[model samples]
Target: MTAILSMLPPDWREGTFLGRLDLGEGPVPVLLAGGTVHDMSGAAPTVADLVDLGAFDPAQGSVLGSAEDVLARAALLSPVDLQCIKAAGVTFAVSALERVIEERARGDADQAQAVRGGLEERIGGSIRSVVPGSAEAAALKAALIEDGMWSQYLEVAIGPDAEIFTKSPVLSTVGSGAVIGVRSDSDWNNPEPEIVILSDRHGKAVGAALGNDVNLRDFEGRSALLLGKAKDNNASCSIGPFVRLFDAGYTMAEIENAKVLLRIEGPEGFLLEGESRMAEISRPPLDLLRQAFSEHQYPDGIVLFLGTLFAPTQDRDTQGRGFTHKVGDVVTISSERLGTLVNTVATSRDAPAWETGISALYRNLAARGLIGGRA
Candidate 1:
């Protein structure tokens, strides 16, 4: 328990955080401020409601306990509720390259190394230097297409538009300390550690959190149509410890310059570490946010994952197989200002089924008198 709590930011006590906490009754919105975790149920029914309201005062909330004591007695949820979960892909040069490798190899781990070497030699430097949608990017694209090296991944990577997709349904995201799932049948897969933005009903960026976007390389590699199977699954999306609201101390600058770190400790004594510097992203974070909100509405709110730059390529067991998660592997994602998110890896087929959904949440809230009635 101590170790899990230690995953939080070193300076957590000083920051303002919003999250969901289940103290055996049901999940309730919690506010951590002035070194105490306060029950914000009096302020709002759900975190989504509190965020949409946009003016919650911690002093008005009832004191639960110190942050440590409260977290110790309760299970922390995904820090988001009733919000649409969205994600951007191929926002980094390395991720774009990996997607191309996955496509060329057709999900075959054995063929990935061969394709990786050729792809890197062909357009690696060019891709890194050119800005997405720029004339230089267009010239490079034309050259790659002429050379027969163009890919759908590259088109999205360097194209005028970004690739934004629904990551998971509302109330489906598991919190830190919960088991994160990958497809059982997927032989090639990895965890994507990213910094997620919390947007209000008005599509305004209000806060940020850490997330593990567990992915199945093999599934998506076989066909783009398998994206649903490869991406969304039971226990697949893990976000939290908590969402740190943007304030005078922790602002957009913290998120813009944040260095998201990943560490995986396998059951068999395999250790791997990597990082994704926000500085290396091909598209600005807000640009992706605008693209996601373009011609759409998320009245409840949204949790948007700014694509990761850390795509593990280290060999886990087999020499050329690259990195693939094993059951019991502990994945930790942390940033200086946003704190840490830790979760264990499990096969989607074996992990606990996603039972509590929007209906269940509404019923629980209504029964607890947290809300008027179920929608």
Candidate 2:
């Protein structure tokens, strides 16, 4: 049985049923409903399209909820709706209005148009926020990646928020290699807490093990806003080759036998920190992210991020409003995943004292005539 609905052009709204036939095995009867078969190989025509052709009887299947009820439960409703549609069969009826929405999003239209239209209608208004691609935007994005790091850095009068400005000559410190560490503070505040290098890949820890949140406090004494910090360096974030998850596919079960170690040599090539177990961390490594992007629409051979960690540190003598970052104490983060992320002790690096890198980018863009008109 097929549920026919008129959707956008190019058969974007039509759904088809697929059946499997065995030539030599004497009449194999495996019929797949709510799914479309493009050719003899049962391949889907569009990668993003769903195969919901109405195969099963909802009456026969377990009746846990209404059409609206189920829809509410499956909030995002892309792949999940596909599963529900296939399972419900003839007994389940979906409002044509509901199916139109799904079709529009997954249709053959351009991605930008689809996303913009959907957000406007679904979220009750158009998006009016305009931000410059300046340093401020960059800083805020970096701060949001974890929880407390940004706030703490801002509080201590360190990082991009610091008032000092001095450029440091690019120095060759270390080679491109992997390093692992843990969140040393029970809470966020300390910058670059001692990192204990782990083995290549071995060992395990629970309750927010690598990829956990390291919380921090920004404007600690003055405001209620929260911030966070972690070793967001490209090398600091490490992960095992594999991950174990529950059947529902939302929670992490356990990290099976994963260990990490590292050795860091100082200015004279003397060991600064060496041979320590990486028990837990606030974020996952770049390699895992690379694998995930590969499975999706990411372009091939894109290096995700550069190694750099910025945390907040306090300065007692220089507590004032509208502070800026300094050069020597600032940590410049450059990543393939994220663009140049620069943070310094409040007094480092002499640039306009903007609140964020996004502002800086916007300034650069405006100067380049990218914004189309004067702001």
Q: For candidate 2, report its TM-score.
A: 0.19
Q: Candidate 1: which stretches are off by over 4 Å? A: 1-4
Give the least accurate 10-residue stretch of model 1, judged by summed lDDT.
1-10
**Could you list the CA RMSD of all candidates, in the order they appear?**
1.3, 26.3
Pick the lDDT winner: 1
Worst 10 residues of 2 by lDDT: 83-92
Instruction: Mark the regions of model 2 whose C-alpha exceeds 4 Å error after superposition.
Output: 1-189, 193-352, 355-360
lDDT of 1 by residue, 1-375 (tens): 324467678888788889988899899898888788889988888898899887557986899888778777788788999999999999999999999999999988889999999999888888999889999999998998899999999999999999999999888999988888998888889999999999987778999999988899999999988988889998999999899998889988888899999999999999999999999999988898899899999999899999998889899888988999999999989898888899999998899899999889888889988778653
Task: Using TM-score, give the best candidate's number.
Answer: 1
Tell me the deviation in Å of residue 75 in model 1: 1.0
Cand. 1 TM to true fold? 0.98
Q: Across residues 1-375, which tens digit of lDDT does each residue of candidate 2 receive?
A: 001111001221121212212233111112121222112112221111111212222222223233233222221100110010000000001111111222333321222234334433532111112121335545544653453222222222212221111101111011111122222322222222211111111111101111111111221222222111222211222221111111232122222112222222223322322111212221233222332233334111111221112222222123321111222232222211111112222211232222323344345335544344453
